[model samples]
Target: MTTGRDILRVTLRRNAGAISAGTLLLGLYQAAETAFPIALGLIAEHTLRERELGSLALSIGALAVIITTVSLSWRFGMRILQQASVTEAHRWRVRVAACGLQPVAGDTDLKSGEILTIATEDADQGADIIEVVPLLISSMVAVLVAAVALGLADVRLGLLVIVGTVAILSILSVLSRRIGTSTREQQARVARAGAKVADLITGLRPLHGFGGNHAGFLSYRRVSTEARTQAVTVATANGVYAGIAQGLNAVLATVVTLSAGWLAFEGRITIGELVMAVGLAQFIMEPLKLFSEMPKYVMTARASADRMALVLSAPPVMAEGRGRPSPGDDLEVEGIVFGGLRELKFRVPAGEFVAVAAYQPGAAADLAAVLAVRVPPEAYAGVVRVGGRELSDLPVAAVRERLLVNPYDGEIFAGTLRSNLDPGGTGRPVAEAVEASMLTDVVALHPEGLDHGVRDRGANLSGGQRQRLSLARALAADADVLVLHDPTTAVDAVTEQLIARNVALLRRHRTTLVLTSSPALLDAADRVLVLDGGAITAEGTHRDLLATDETYRLAVSR
Candidate 1:
């Protein structure tokens, strides 16, 4: 597990060369800027003392060199630093995205909106640390070099510059801490607001149909208002900090100028030295301001990095199995006790069509999850076997390739119908799956047929259409064992009947498990298991169970 500090260290190490070059160039630029006023003062003194044209030309030439160096170094240094910052952001974004995609144990309690914020906004903030270090080093180098040059010219003036800079930074550091706290609160509020909006948008159609749109709107508005208030508070703090920084800088510069003027008036320092003191005093303001803001950047970057580390360091939910699954179609659940399943035992032979009618909704979902490998084996006390081999001992990839559990509410990505149906480009003939899933009517409605555009999460399609499309995609996988949970609930009775018959015929020689309460699907299966009270109480053909078991009859009737 990596901490925030470890992440920062790794990032710095990765970009060490770029950081060093940028820091060196920036420091040289600051040095050259400081030299300008000193050169002017020296030229003035030389003119008054020697009155030599040759010496004047040489000083002017040196001033030009300093000006050129300042411009060139500043331009190149900023380019390098900015590019490095962008690259760092890109790296963090990719890492966070990949981590989010992996299956991890336990609940992360992170919504899609929060994950989006971390990958985008928080990633940029984490990358800002790249610039903060180099800028701090360069600013300190400038301040130190300026102070030394001033002291070399006149001891009193140099002492004033160093003492004033220290006082200003001390005050600003306290204020920056406050800013950091406020920024964290602001970011959290914004994330919550974004999450609320995303949820509302995803369920907009349902909310509107149920006449809950107005209530949902009020909820979103409340969260949005809170985020707005936090943002305002953050902005106010930043404004106050900026004002204080600028005002203090101006006051210090004024004091330094006045002191230099008094020394020149008293003939304690030459005219050139007095000019250099005033110039150095004014020039130090930018570096002082940069130094004051470094603490705030550092704090923000630490917070963002910590958020990123939360995702990156999450442990996997289950240890991966090293063994591959053996070739077989039989699936056996022995003495299974997890969630709503209590000492459940069942077996489906090779090339058999089995249906499980679970009365409890939670049991149905939990059973589906167990079959899909969504839950860790450690969470349950059971032995699930395929081809006489334990599922826990088989590699996840091999199990997934052989057995596919299509949940009732599967996801539909944004793309063409054809792409969604055949994402792997397996070239397994989309027409057969579409026909078996009874989606031919949907494909025929659009001129583009399989190429018809689908919105995000199949928003553009009807609920029934989306369900059929999801079934079609699962069928296209051509897995040896297919488990479907209520695959025809969204469609009408006629469509459901057609889909059930078509699926039975299409997968006649394959092992299939259907967990549903629908009569059409249950009647189509070769065997039906009545699951109740965490156990299978009865098992037989669908018609036999319906006639002999009252509980099973009532469950399928609804």
Candidate 2:
């Protein structure tokens, strides 16, 4: 459960200046609006008694005008607050993205989708308090204004109304505590369900292949049902709190009316005073409801705040170490080791084709990650040097700019073929890259060509097509060095041969690292590095390794 102080802190931290001013203006307008009804009741009593023509009519008209002005002001103030809250949400989302993009050292575990959910969903919730809190405070002011009007009518009636209002408010406050707990639990359940659904959908193919559809779907259904149940719990609690508050207000209204009538009968107050007290009841009831409703809103807002905090608090995946490396274009990995790879050293000339075959594919994948600067060199015990400079010693952005690594599982985002092939091209020509990646055949087969629309993650494209499109994207990047992991794994042998040949031709003079067990790709490489047990056990041509290295032979064996 979140406290009032926590919700206030989040609102102020996000948009303090705008929210504070909006709240003050709203409170002032509500105070005036609350007084309008009482002023109308007094005017009515004076008109009936004295039958005044000019003065009474003018006063009543002026009060009506004031009520109109207050209504307009409240509307405009609400607009300003809503706009400010939305702006705060937008700014918070940008901050979340900035934090997520901080060096990988501190952000590895943060999922992109999770950050998106936090920024939009959680931030919106946190901002909701900006609109709700001021109205809640104004409601209390309305209740006070009613108390003052009722007091002028009859002291006993005023005391009864104030005490009853306080009691109703107290009940509301108690119920609000329960609201916060339920809201927090509900939000957690929803987030968990969202993450699970996303994971299940993304890995649907693998799950189906493993024949775990029934079990996986059943588990997902269970999680979904749990989330629904929590939502129902929250809704039930909110409804009960509202019902009780409304019921108490009705009871208070009856008690106040009966008390006012008793006072009038005893010759303690006038009939006009009885009418005034009845009129004040309506004013007090609405604000009472508003005040009561606020706690539930505040509770929801706090739950959202906590969710946003989770995203903000996530650490980046990588850290920038001290010192800067000299800028250059060569690629080198000294004492590189991770996963199955032990302490190994290797360097690629500024423009060369190097193929690596590892007995354990995980070792090759880890080494590729280290070489591409995706995984920190420190995670293993090594130095990955680019352009004769250690990668860790250079800014991450600069390293990323000079190098491109396209893993086999790279996503093909929903977009036209042109957008998928050349995302950052900004309408630049992608024909060369498409042709070089042998995607000319793919385009020729499609009537839409580069304009063909791909579904999310290329659900519309075949596995091999997705891989080829990924390769085309990398080719279009025109990076200095490109590392590809099992790029042709999903393609047929004939297609693989064509892609392998095209990849080598396209990257003729560029520094390219291909992690593969394919003989065709290895045969095209200028040199082959055989990874066995852990370290690079042999370095030679593809033919040489096949003849001399038992581990490489076994790994490359069909």
Candidate 3:
């Protein structure tokens, strides 16, 4: 359904005023250039032949005026066109990013790296259509003016130039179609190669130990090689197309020059007219070449627009809502029937710390999705409420404000340690959150303490360090309800116990849920619920459940 013409039409509609004014100025510039040789021909035929001083001076002044017009018009016209192109490109790039960042996941087949390519390179090329339109119009204006001037001197010359140009363009147009197909293929291949590199970089450390890096390299190399092959195919098509255009252009120029000479030898035109005809014939070559190159710009813009449209046209997966509940911290899930959950239900009063251990591994993620507001109401048979109101009725932003569902291995951005912990500086104190998450040693490891610079995505930090920092960042948010899924997966047993104890003490008055089977966190919880066979089958304090229920003991120990 995405024809890619949508982006092109929208871009043109928004910049209509700018394009009109810029094209007018550019047309004037091309007209001025066309007039230069005509003025010389007139001065040579009248002023110099008369041998009169006043006429020569006037002719020189006229030539100076024409030169000044050419210089000024070209300078200002290009400035306006270039500015519009840059601004339009920036606008599209930001629009693409905004679409990708929406809280409700969109139904898109594009991967992360492919989206990045579309937002940056594809946007930039598509905006070149703005510049291409004006330039193409100006080139046509130059050719039209030249033909008119030639016709005034000799009718055959004008007809021949126009007819020959049409013929050459018709031939080149067919070759350009082949170029368009190859260029589009080249763009897709490059995007796939980019996706491979992004995947490899994301898991670089883990991949390095298991020869995954080598396997990824082999995969990337194949994609890269395919991209290069497509690039070569595109290059071959363009070369053949340009070669034919130039060859035809040279033949047309040569024929016109010969015809003008024959007419002069037959005394059919004056000497000055012949000079003008020859000069105009030579000058027309540039405008004709401009005609030949326009197809390449059109093809590139169309291909980029197609890629951008893929991202922009993706469908949103959740309903748009603006409803919110009255303020409270109570969490409730009743008759929740989702994937693998058969009427699963649970509740936690305000200021309670609870741990959920699921025998079925996927059960934990199902619970996280419900609390995180990731599922659409129409897609499931359940009602999840916070503060006595349904989650589906509330705006996604409002839900996020009330409950922070920190995912496993949460993302880390490039910044100082303190900035990573409290990015907005609106959360709980950095020292307090860091201490509670057992990240005190990380601060001490760097002499600058919280000021220590962290690499992008914590690439320079160990997995355990990244995990603890993720925990610390979430702890600082001060949300009404907090859920941590497998927060201690990467840490040692001793460190996990300390983190559980400190987190429990720091969040004593806040509602918190730990969705993990880690023994340290489970034992530290005020109460533990065992989820098995798609429902909560047993519930008690961790020590009591361990002694009383064999299923709870086995599941937690796993």
Best by lDDT: 1
Q: Model 2, 1-558: lDDT tens per residue?
A: 333355458667767777677777787787777667667766777778888688687877789787886887788789888998888777767876776555354443435556666677877887787888778878887787778778887777778878988788788889999989988888777777777776666667668888988888998899889989999998999899989999998888788878877888998887677777777776677778888788888878877777676656654445565555455567887886678878888888978999988778888777767766666555778777878777767667777778788887886788889988777766534777787667888899889989888887777676678888888888888788888888888778877777778878888888898889888899889999877777888899988878987877777866
lDDT of 3 at 96: 87
User: Can you give the lDDT of residue 126 in candidate 3?
Assistant: 91
lDDT tens string, model 3, 494-526? 999899999899889788988999988998888
Candidate 3 residue runs with Cα over 4 Å from true position: 1-3, 103-106, 415-419, 422-428, 447-451
Question: Of the candidates numbered 1 and 3, which has the greater lDDT value?
Answer: 1
RMSD of each: 2.7, 3.1, 2.6
lDDT by candidate, in order shown: 0.88, 0.77, 0.85
Number of clashing pairs per prediction, in order: 1, 15, 0
TM-score of 3: 0.92
Sequence-dependent TM-score of model 1: 0.91
